[model samples]
Target: MLEIKDVAFGGKAVGRLEDGRVCFSPDALPGERVQVTVTRETKRFVEAQLDRVLEASPRRVKPPCPYYGACGGCSYQHAAYDYQVELKTKQVGDVLGRLGGIENPNVLEGVPSPLPYGYRNRITVHRHGGRIGFHRRDGKGLVDIEACLLASDEVNKRLAELRRERFHEGARVLREHASRMGFHQTNDGVGALLQDAVSEACGSGGCLIDAYCGDGFFAHRLAKKFQRVIGLEWNERSIAQARSVAHANESYIEGDVAARLAEVLEEADGAATTVILDPPSQGLDVQVADLLRAYPVAKIVYVSCNPATLARDLKSLAAVYELGSATPFDMFPQTAEVEVLAILRRRF
Candidate 1:
């Protein structure tokens, strides 16, 4: 029996074993005593399987999805939606402090998703051996599913149509609509909040350089705030789309960010320039970080999907930038994933 102390960043509850070794288990909540069987043992910690809940937490609730445990897509289904946000908010601060080495990180409350379930606009289901669904929790094989509760009605309708027919062994992506080819956030409502946060941080500037700006998602929205908005992207399709709807003041460049960012920064007004970085899960490239430090902008609004990588990059930029605020958005609720927006100001 172990007392679940805290829920880690990956939605796993952490506890200490009787032998003083740390133990991690899923499907367990903090403040609950659970009986677990050791599955894997390492020198530092042990992985366990939750056998029984000796004491359940008040935050625990019955998962609406029938395949909650079996499906690996949603981890916090058993946890209350509000509690999940709270945990995510705390996890951001914890990760920043632990990984970034920032003392007493100022992490604001997490912005919750309007619709906890049925919010995803897109999902990819794997078809293996005539089974069409997501991978199992253990990731060993695919679980045949009829409907996904997390997907929107439109997406679910497409999934139902795909299920009725037979397909070969491959992954089929089901989306509500045939949007332009590029990356888009699965949750629409929370994604707007994310954009608002980035926009608010950007405020008004002489020039806006949106790095990794896909289809001018933030650049176009924030174009009015600046005399000119320049967007940088690597995808030819995304750049074309961004230029198709480009405003008189907006210009998009297609190429590697590391290669083109320096020229964009050199041309922008250094005193009133603001750069919005919405990089991939890997965070900023080493060259990009070095460039931002070399050419300090007035402000940098960073949007990240992975906290660990965000924290790592923030630590690297501490010398040139001072963190103003770090806010998290529960863009992907009922899962371990979170989107954080950090605003940084150049240090004199």
Candidate 2:
């Protein structure tokens, strides 16, 4: 059994073992003394589950989800909502300062999600055998979940209907064949809020080029703010969706982003462009990085899910563009992941 000591980086409790090694315990908050059972141990640290809370922190709250600890989908739902925001902000600041080498950087206050719960627009329910839900934190077990508090009501209703159809029977097959394309919108109101923020930051009188544009989300919304909007996406389904929503003033191309941007720029008639890139957690491809540096865009807005990769990409892009501001968004409130929105202007 382990006793909780203090809070560690990922909102887990840091406690030392009898042999002087460290263990990280989830569901054990700071200022709380708990008896924990070591589930898995490693040479450096250990992973534990809370066995008993000898002393409880005042910040602890009742988690509304029944599958809270069993399902790894949400970790900090037991923590206070306000405290969740605080921890996320600190995590972003630490990543920027420690990894990005931006000391004393002006980190904007996190853009809080309008509705923290039931905000997720999309959810991937995994099914192996008769089980369907998220995998356990230990990555070894599966917990069947009937409903997810994080998913939007619409998605939940759809999920229920899908389940009634016994969709889990051929989940793997359906997932493979599903067009994998649809309008991407956060069931939560955060997408709209993010659109507003991007619009306000970029302002008017500039062309906006969105790389990695999925279904032309921001491209469709922000086309009015710019003299012209051009979107580049690799997914054919997403490209088709974008085309369906495209106005006469907006254009979208389907091809590899790094390879196709040069041609897209040439076709733009030398318009000054503001580039907004929202890449996956793997971050930007090196080839794309080179293109951004070579082309002189007015401003670049980079939206990223992983801080470590974002820092690395920013460090590489710093040579060509001046990093103006960074705002972290708590898109995934309960998890360690954060969404960082960075604004960069081309150097003269």
**Candidate topping TM-score:** 1
Off by over 4 Å in 2: 1-11, 15-22, 39-44, 168-180, 265-271
Off by over 4 Å in 1: none
Over the stretch 105-154, how does candidate 1's per-residue lDDT look in tens digits?
98988999999999999999999987899999988899899999999999
- State the lDDT of candidate 2 residue by residue for 63-126, as single tens digits: 9888887787777888887777766777677777777777765678888777879788677777
- Model 2, TM vs. native: 0.86
TM-score of each: 0.98, 0.86
lDDT at position 202, candidate 2:
71
